[model samples]
Target: MSLEAQYLANKLAKGFVGTNQIESNSRLCMASAGTGYKLSLGADGPPGSYRDFEKADVFFVIGSNTADCHPILFLRMMDRVKAGAKLIVVDPRRTATAEKADLYLQIKPGTDLALLNGLLHLLHENGHTDPDFIAAHTEGWEAMPGFLAEYPPATVAEITGIPEAGIREAASLIGRAGEWMSLWTMGLNQSTHGTWNTNALVNLHLATGAICRSGSGPFSLTGQPNAMGGREMGYMGPGLPGQRSVLVDEERAFVEELWELPPDTLRKDGVGQGAVEMFQKMADGAIKACWIICTNPVASVANRGTVIEGLEAADFVVTQDVFAETETNTYADVVLPGAMWTETEGVLINSERNLTLASPATDPPGEALADWQIIARVACAMGYEKGFSYESAEDVFEEIKRAWNPKTGWDLRGVTYERLRAGSVQWPAAREEGPDRNPIRYVDRDGELSFPRASGRAVFYARPHIPAAEMPDDDFPFVLNTGRLQHQWHTLTKTGKVARLNKLNPGPFVELHPQDARELGIVDGDAVEVASRRGRAVLPAVVTDRVRPGCCFAPFHWNDLFGDCLSINAVTSDAVDPVSFQPELKVCAVGLAKVSSPRRPCPSPSSRLRSSTCTDH
Candidate 1:
């Protein structure tokens, strides 16, 4: 068994099973970026801060709707743009962020690797690389040229469907800039080539010597709140607390000693099962029962058919959440009502590595309780009272402060709610020293431009581009893309409760160009059945130029609760990137068949018509 499977087995032996049962929704989101960051930098977490955007000379944002999703970060990026910094947006949609971009490349989806490598090829071919920095601070770059040689400007232009001039413009902006910052989100992370997409971006920064300076580095925007903190706390399978990996003997020893556990108490191997692998195990009945928390994978993860099958096959399932009703709740044998963020007191770590303390605005209602309280109770019930007897959130934070890896400069000693009440504090804070006012990390290690890699040099990965796992074909004639809505959040457990937010976007709809709709004998407001090899969904159509002629867009917020057979994930493919194990949520091949107009505005799930029939409403 892998270390991840053994870890779960150990937990099951202790009568404790959490995300080890399946996986969090992050598997559908940031898993790829996390994998790429770790492999490239020898660690996860950003090497730059949010403040770098202000000092950046050129900014490139790909696969992110920052203006809508991370509005505050977008506002911060806008500050630099107004101050004369050039902005480049890479996306398929003409989003609010893209509209203001100095250069917008609506490149074909899933072709990020080619576009990025194309940038590198231009940088080297045009004498834009910094040789002194490359020689002194990096390694393994010789292999890059041969690998990237295939991605010449013309070839990249052909593959990306972007003009050759636009490619050069974006390439020149990045190559020529002294201080460049690249930001991306789910667009790059939610693809079959997500890891390579990330490494390819990092390769650009390394080739141009654009990283570890005052205003430059690759920064991946966090879509989920406190995702950085979650990683630091060892929320994933392979990692230990404080950026330590389970496979490292010294790290394992460090954690065991701190926790006062016996020798060899922790797993020595780092072979942890990723989210997709865990679900596959569930479907195979390798895992008998499962426990899930804080996420709704049914509506978020790709290949909902497999996810539903895995859940149905489980011997027992427990789910903990703020809402009593959710798609996952339908499969749960036990539901634990835990307090939401508004009712929890804890510290949230932002993309900038700033720790903001969250104090509960009000107490929990009815039988609901804080998540930590539920967890602490579970530990006591399972006979781990001594280790889990945390009376307050501060107690938990203090433990992490002492337990975090000191070698990685991840000290959290002085951070406390009392001190954080004034404002946010960036990390690498000391126990004796006051809060760190600095936001930058690895800006200049050891008072010099250095890195934490083994050779004190960055490794340039010579990545090759691969097509998306699923491509549009004759049977599945259109590309179906799934993503977030400006008004709705993941699975809509909280946002669905807001009347105003729902008014902004009430139901699921697919965006198709008027040309494609006309050819398919479909129009705006007509029911359409989108069928992939994996699953199918029925959605109303909205004719617009927002999407490419051959592509369709669907927001994933609508769960089964919406009544009509609408779930973009249902029609999504489970084929994941081998490197990151993050599924291809952004690209799936689907054939469109117009459904007959229902007698009453879209009836129950069972009443949905076949995709072949179409009629006037």
Candidate 2:
């Protein structure tokens, strides 16, 4: 963690005079995973690393469209598939990832918990569960089987819309597999039942001793590259570095002494705002000055119209990012030019917990600065001079090492800047271990059980299924799902500038089932307007069979800054999971309309775009 952020988190939490809050974009993408991981195993990062991908015989890739978002990791999975590993993809859309699956369970949206419980029911019925392991290394495992009784194949099939036979077949594949590695992303995390979705997936591993094995565990593929690092460094609310929480007295005391601050620097009586709630506080005039860095939340946050209104309502708003022309900067009171990825040097921790040092390939443009440097300057300006004087990125690295204390079990003392610059290494590699030593978690395979939980054992959550916060009705007759395109990165701040990339997906478009399109009198190039109770988006429509009949897909990458088109989040619902507070961005109800514009339809990037380039599925 940066000293500036740590100090402020402490101050703000303590309700120190003149301080209000410190929030981040971390809550939007990984909050549910974070909450579930901590609840299940009593920590942030997952027990399994990417190395498990190489040793596994069965890969359950659910919720995530790995082929689009984490293309490199998906390539590795494909290598395993070719080597005879069976792949199972669970999703509502026939995504690129699902197309490669040995079994694609086209589940009903928001019914993942039911499907997972149904798997456990089958596992128990077939006597595939590992009672010895559960008895020895787990708490609450005895109770899970009883809960699974309510969700038999027939019952789950009714809710999930997957055939009962398909459910049984999937259960058999997962049950009898040599090793299992389960993965998911936004599709599971961005929903009202996100935490439950995650815990339910984890339940499978706990039920059958599928975790902590050489190639077995539940893995949440990070949407953002350094999301794991951000969590480890206490970027979220109620957090301190080393996976410590402010709510814990011992952890709070450790942080207080680590920074040599007054005992009251961090508040005791209140919790800070998350991303979704922060905007609510802003609109209600409870917060004054708001600062956003790195993320383009204006175009990305669920309910785009409301978030922009909150930004506008702030007394003072600051946006620090690479682009000067972003929709966010349009409303900013001050713009701090942040250096782009190619123009900055720092460490990025990927989904697997590997610490990778990214070196700048070119100098930053005029007046722009690295993210950390900008933060340091701002801290000094705010009169925190002593700790804010960082000479280089390595200075921050040294501080991070200090913050990664032994007690945290994420001891990174061996991972020096010099060693990291040469290669990456996973966390928990202590100084006694070599600098290059990589680590996997939870040593249960050798009959030695270790969970990060206070009980010294993993906990199985009997979480129940909950429907999506918003569902389609007569007024809003289709479910609107928003996500990424293969060639276009989030918001397209950098990729949109590429001519070749533009030739792939030229503008904003919504993908609906051809049956729904035909029923609504829409065509491939028809201009359409999709509306929700919150807002509306106008874009070109793509009639495809990839999405289910009542569900539609829209790429969340385009906006006025990129193609002078609509942002999908405008029509996305802001309803959030009560536990994670992450908006239900993946599923919402919207009505689609065919626009009768007098102007000619924009030319398709090429005829093959409908086939080759539309990776939205």
Candidate 3:
């Protein structure tokens, strides 16, 4: 079905002239990291693997709360830490992960680039770089020193709110490590300067020759299962199957040849609209119809008012999901029930590039079908019979092998469904290379260095630090941030229904500093109305020092389904990075006021988006 979705998207793009609008939900989460990886390392997947974590001498975790978000990986990291590996954490909030850090820099939000550049500057100053590696394996190194000089410790400390001594100590720790690994997620990716934030981190690794090795590399941890596979399958708007881009003629030709299509079967224009732009176009009536699969955009997207408007304004909307009562289904003209986890058989590729096949243990209820089945059925209904005629999941998997371009060093031809059913396998499973699948990337089994770039060398990007799209003013004095809780998953479609999980994390609340709460004349559990330039939401205030004084935090799990106007996306900024188009959901300016009861009624589903007001009951 994954192959069918890609096939149908390509066909639809070919049929529709002058517009290509196929996109994936990863745009909201990992697009910045993807763009950054391609820009600096010449490809998207991590150069190092999870095996590196065990052998690492130092671990640098930024932007992610790994303890709660990725518990199993956190356990592995802790195991390494127990064996004498130093752990460094950088975040705006002093999270549970930070609590265990050997060195924790609780820096200000959205200032990752500044802090990273400062560390790189210090690394160079302290003579920690591998000049030999840079000359041999990397390119564009001569231009970085001058740009890095702009981020001295003093300036970075001021920008990030971490002390100068702390900054220097962090650099020294990273510089002295025998082998270090960096881990990050949406905290760095969901910002206006997200791409540069990633670029700077890669810059550090390249400077120290910390990548393409056993115990060191810059690893972007994905929050979702199969997100890496989705990218490999070309789910991004501008992509074709096997990470090929429509913008590149040779890559397009390869896919066209594999699919047995004509020379110009795929669209040749620019990359298609990202999620933010896609909804904006739908709201503008440029996109007449949309088919959303396995995602709830209304609850998850920043500037969700626009998403709501987009759904309401579109000529037709189809939502294929496992749950019937999703916030997105209210606006969907056609609701297709998709099979749940154990009810469907498919393959999932996890963060470490491990491919695992899941066999169905139970049948789907009612008329529900697998996601791919739904796509193939729709394609056949639309008269694309021959292309969509795949007999089984194994047949689609076979075509996926053909879709891979060997030149990219991501050969999947050796992988068979039979092999996958027995046990999991990491990718770059070349037909010629026998059973051993190397977890590490960018190098051959012979340990030869070869980047997939045009120059066959990893490139260094001279990127600059930029502030968040919206800064706090008197009207909106506090910086509002959103993230996940330990117990609940995204928007709580599944976990919210679990009684134990609900008991662990009962409901959503606004987390502010005790100082801020005192200043606002509020107490713990007080109903506080937080209003941003975009929209507003009211929740109980949890007064603590988990977050910095000038900043506040909220979990984005609750939505209208749980209560009236509980969606925290209402208060998030829609500003996106120009390069990656990933929204800065991590930072926005919002004001807080104590409320007695619900001051305003929750906005109706059919309400105009410009109103920008929401409520909780």
Candidate 4:
């Protein structure tokens, strides 16, 4: 048996059974806050209610690729296309999602803040702001117009490469849409300015009163199926289970009381370093140890070469994953084989805040252990026996739910393990008797809508448009954007093992506009050297007009198996967004050159000819 499975089996042998079995439907009825239940009144009954290709009056796609990455969701958008819904794709490149958009606003990389500011300006100028909503439930109203006044459509158009009319139209569409929803993924969050980007989008929705209702609100599409659960379980840095930050003294005290830890043992107000900062600290020898679970930092982090150095520099590095051959595991001092998602009974929270249970379909292979079991054991090893003495995944989940439910208005007593196992429930399932929990939130009992902030008011932030930390200049003329391909998953720990999936896009290739390719003396199937101030990578070039001029895109999934090539992140800059500390993976300046050596021969001529047939540019 793999080490991880063996660990799980041992835990089960020690009398760990599933905790609080609740039906799936019951779980869906609960809310994250555990108080003041949510209600579903319209078409947005449940997260699964909408599918890909479904017609939306106005489709605002920010940082995500609905097609290649989320094909199922993408199909729903296609449904909308057939129904004549206007699709507006905002991305750094002509992604598959962008290609299908009715209007593709190919903005300059990492300039989302500027683009959003311009949209806000247009909305205010055209008198599209919701006056009643703003007066009733928002702060910072007076200072907003002054902040937006500096970002005229023409200024935004100059920086983002979007036409003035296009900017105006996009703003007008969003402002006037009867039902609108905004979808964003890694494109917005995986940047130095990720937080700012998120807040900017939220600012617009708040300005026009477009959130917490059917076909409305700002949705942050998580990358992993269980990333939401991870956040719920306090797996994120400096967070307690149930959306509680560790910085709050009351929250910290509550958690410490639950765990019975001494005041000094638990962190007080320190925020854990973000991904990039963590690695940089490790590289600098500040952080002595790291335990990586379910993620491959070496292949996924920007400037991957630096990530390797950080791992190498760590005094101890532990990698727990289902596969033994991940790029991260190769560098680990100890490789703990972990159970695959299919081999474990757990829960995953989706983008819509719906919690779904994943039952184990098969027994684990070898000694592979479940993630929770490993964590428990580690906790025990650290001498927190009582706190970590959970017998099952259910028990751990119960503790998490309890932590989330505070009696002082944040009660989630209705959602027990028994209820969750029976059915999926939206959060805020405080009153079991409350009118069939909200499908749409922030709407009061009297049907009056509002924001969810402390004062029941949305705060409008005056965010300025800042240029990408790294810009194209004489040294690096091409802007590089990194993202996913249709077939490959993040870091390729599991997806890489599937031969059929690997066949889709076999290796790393820089997608460039035909004009730029010609200018650089590059052709289809030609190897190219892409360099930046941070690092450099060599990959095959697929010259095509599918991409816009002066910008290039590369998928982040390739590694040695794809041809010993460095990951695209090798050259990505480590600059972070000021607010969220997210690395700026969306935009960086790079210089590309044709590889002259025949040592790496181009793909067959037929391959080049076949690739040329699909150009829409």
Candidate 5:
């Protein structure tokens, strides 16, 4: 172990915080916290079961290449496609998954809300809405029509660059389909209006009554394997394990009891900060101590410079990872060595709510320990020995399942570790029915289904077409959309270690339309400097016809590897959606300039010969 790792281990042994084991008999205990219908857990009201992905029939994928990011479960989507499911892909560039899609809507960056609202308007006008479902299950339906009235196809076409006919066609496909799903990834979440983008998609699903059933839902594909699991365990701000929010008194009491702590001793009512707020706090010095487990915020979060600044400014920072060297760990006061995915025993909840286990295929590297073990030891030191005690991951899983079980409907009374050991089992697996778990939930044999609402109906949230947080203009002429490459993962933390993977695509490059490249005198393999109000980076230009004019695409995976170049996020805005707080990394205004020479004494005869010359002319 490195000196930093030893320091963290020593601290944990001294007892700073208590670790509590979470067990579950019903795999449903692992559901994500937000964007789902609210449910009651007998004595406590936990957040509702999320159905956005699980219930989708016709899935509209905008800005996400799930095939590359979440490869394992993405096969389920491929199966659905082969079964003749309708897939709509909206991205500036045609990606691998887009090649297999039934329809690919190549839209400009930052225009998602306009395109989504246009579809909703068309759905409303075409008489495709389920009035019965709206009247029974929803509260905000009446406000939706009024809100959508402003986003006509022509107006949306002008903003999004998608033809009116395409908008109408997409609406027709979604409205006529038996069930529809809308799935998005960082493309939608990393934008200034990311939360609004998520809310807008949910609005469409609810309006059409397409949620909470088989093959119909609005799902947000998580970037990390344990992103969903983290939420379930209340690792995020303002959440408790089992979908319980921190705001509720009873919910807080339940966790307090689970931890065997007095209500007065535990923090009762502080609002949990999101990623953005957390970093902001770090930068401003309000949050002096931060322990980052598993995630690398510096490389992954938007504005790499600012994220690093925040980390450096922190009074104390702790990072737990298997790797000795990481971008985030470089700034840590102490680093704890934790097991890698293949070297740990834990559960991961995928986009489809499918629970899978990662068993220890190999022993951890030198001095490295399982994440739970480290956390449990810390908890013991913090004086929470009763809750932190755990002999195995199975013990944690068992307790989490019991917490999720109620005496009544849809409880997980039947599932056991023995069954899980047999194979990966979907949630809601009752003990009595050996392996007959509910693969496709909320649907009746007759093909009709009811939403999981008090009235058994799905309500459409009337979401208006809000403008993007940032708009392209003369100063920043191109819309810069940031995303991942085919082989690379987020921030290049682990994936960067593999030589073969790095060889496929070595460094970051700006993907541009042929016309834009020609107009800017940007040749393929030519280095170009992309700049925004926030920051800038010089990268190679990959001219292709895949992207439309007036926009450019860049990957978010490069840092330190290539000239300490600024990350695309450095130029991305921090404007967030009101609901989800997801940043708008999908859309931002930027300008590109080709780098002519390594060292230039004076301007050359060719206008393009000057590295700093503006390419607009």
Candidate 6:
């Protein structure tokens, strides 16, 4: 299904006369990490594997609440901790994951790059960096030290709100560890300067020579199951199949030849519009049509007013989804019922590069078809019969195998459907016969480092800290940080409907520090109006010390389906990182005020506090 989607996207680019509008939901989540990896490490995938969790001497977790968001992997890290590995967590909130950390730095929101640079400076000052490794395996290293010096501990402490001692402690822990793996997620990626944040995090590993080894590297935790799979298939506007970019001439030629198309079939002048730009263009009437698949952009996209305007302005809109009641469906000119996961078979790649074949367990309820079938049928209808003539999902997978270019080091030729049926396999499976799966990238069998860049070495970026596009001021005095809860997923598509999960997380509520709650004359369970420059949402306030005094936290799960004016994304900033074009969904400025009257009263304070724990600072 993923392959067919890419195939259709490529075909559309060929048939259409303008820039390709194809973009993935990953643009909102992991595009910054992807751009950062490619710029620094010559690739998009993480260099480390889950096995690193068990063998690492230290776990440096930042911007991720692993206990709630990635419980299974968190369990492995905790298991390693029990065997005497130190754990360090850094975030704006003192989350459930931070409770188990040897050290937790409650840094201010959107200060990750500063905090990271400060740590690197402290590491260098403490003589922890490996100069030999820097000289041998990395380029552009000479430019970093001078830039890093600007972010000394005292200055970074003022910027990040972490005590100077806390900054020194984190630096000491990371510097002293023989092997440490850094893990992060949307907290670092969902920012206006998200790409730099990722680069700074990677710089630590490079400086310490803590990467391309058994138990050390920078690993990005993915928010979705098959987001990596989608990247592999090149579903984004700037990508071709097999992780090849449209901007590269050789890569474009390889894909064109494999697809049996003429020269210059793919666009190479410049990259296409990204997710944010795609919708903005739609609203401006530059783009006339859109085909949305398996995503609820109305509730999920930041600055959703613009997204709704885009949908409303488009000449035609097609929504392919399993559920008919998604917020996006309201804007669709045509609603194509697509089979759900259990009713369709496909391959799903996870953060660790493992490919698992998902087999159907049940049939579709009505006239629903698999997503690939729907796309293929549409392609045939549009007179692209030869390119999209796939009889089964296996046929599409076989074509995807032919499209895999081994030079990208993501070789998928050996990842056949039959092999996948037997068991899950990791990629870079270049050969038909041996265990071609490599856990770590950039390192060959002889333990020699070989990056895929033209220089055959990784690049060091001297990125300085940049504040979030929108910062809190007197008018909007609180930074609104959005995230997921343990019991709910994005927009609560399926999880919200489940009885037990609903019981686990009753409804949407805002987390406010007790001091801020008191200052605003709001109490736990009191109705509070959280207003941003763009929009506003009214929810119960949970006066918890989990959040910083000047920062508020809310789960971005609730929408109109739950209740009136419940979508938190309506209040998120659409400001995008210049490099990755990913929106800063994590941090935005907002003001809070108590509501004197409420249409629907909130649940008891105890019920609301059950999901999120609180403590007095």
Cα lDDT listed for each candidate: 0.71, 0.72, 0.79, 0.60, 0.59, 0.78
- lDDT value, residue 217 of candidate 4: 66
The C-alpha RMSD in Å for every predicted model, in order, reads: 4.9, 5.9, 3.1, 8.7, 7.4, 5.6
**249-285: candidate 5 lDDT, tens digit per residue:** 7766765666555664334344433455556667788
Backbone clashes counted, model 3: 1
Show pairs that collide, candidate 3. Answer: 1-372
Which prediction has more favorable lDDT, 1 or 2?
2
Candidate 1: worst-modelled 10 consecutive residues by lDDT: 1-10
> How many residue pairs of model 6 clash at the backbone?
0
Q: For model 1, what is the error of residue 414's alpha carbon versus the real structure, in angstroms, after optimal superposition?
A: 2.9
Residue-wise lDDT of candidate 4 within 1-617, one digit each (tens)?
Answer: 21122223222222122111101111111111111111111111122224322434787998678788788777877777687778899986777898898778987777888999899888899989888878887788799898898899889999888898889889988878876677776666555555566668777877887766566666655566654454444443444545554566777667656655566344543343445566677788977777677666666655454567678788999888777887677678998877877788766656555656666889998888788787777767766576577787767665555665432123344555566577766555566554324455556568775443456565776768776665666656777777778887767777788999878767678787888877777777676666554444566777776667887777768764445544665222112212221122222212333254523332221221111111111
Candidate with more favorable, higher TM-score: 2 or 3? 3
TM-score of 1: 0.90
Find the candidate with the highest lDDT and give its number.
3
lDDT (tens digit, per residue) of candidate 1 on 22-72 = 234445666677778776766677788877877999999998888988888
Error of 5 at 413 (Å): 5.0
Worst lDDT 10-window in candidate 2: 606-615
Q: What lDDT does model 4 reach?
A: 0.60
Better of 1 and 4 by lDDT: 1
Q: Over 4 Å off in model 6, which ranges?
A: 1-7, 14-19, 570-617
Query: Any runs in candidate 1 off by more than 4 Å, and if so which?
Result: 1-22, 268-272, 443-446, 570-617
**Model 5 regions lying over 4 Å from their true place:** 1-33, 36-58, 70-84, 405-413, 430-436, 440-457, 561-563, 570-617
Candidate 5: residue 163 Cα off by (Å): 0.6
Mark the regions of model 4 whose C-alpha exceeds 4 Å error after superposition: 1-56, 405-413, 416-421, 431-437, 448-450, 570-617
Per-residue lDDT tens digits for candidate 2, residues 1-617, read 23333333333333223233555556667888888887787777778778888999999988889998889889999999999999999988899999999999998777888998999899999998999888877899768777889999999999999999999988999899989999988788877777777888888898899887678999998877677877777766777777777777877777677666667565544466566666767877888778788777777776555566678788999888888888777778999887876777777777777888777899999999887888777777777766567788877677667666543367667787788777887877676356464546755236576887667888899988777666666666777777788898888888989999889978778887888887777777777766555545557778898988887888888875654337665221112324222222222112333254412232121211111111121
lDDT of 3 by residue, 184-246 (tens): 988888777777778889999999999889999999999776778887777767777777788
Please give the lDDT score at residue 405 for candidate 4: 40
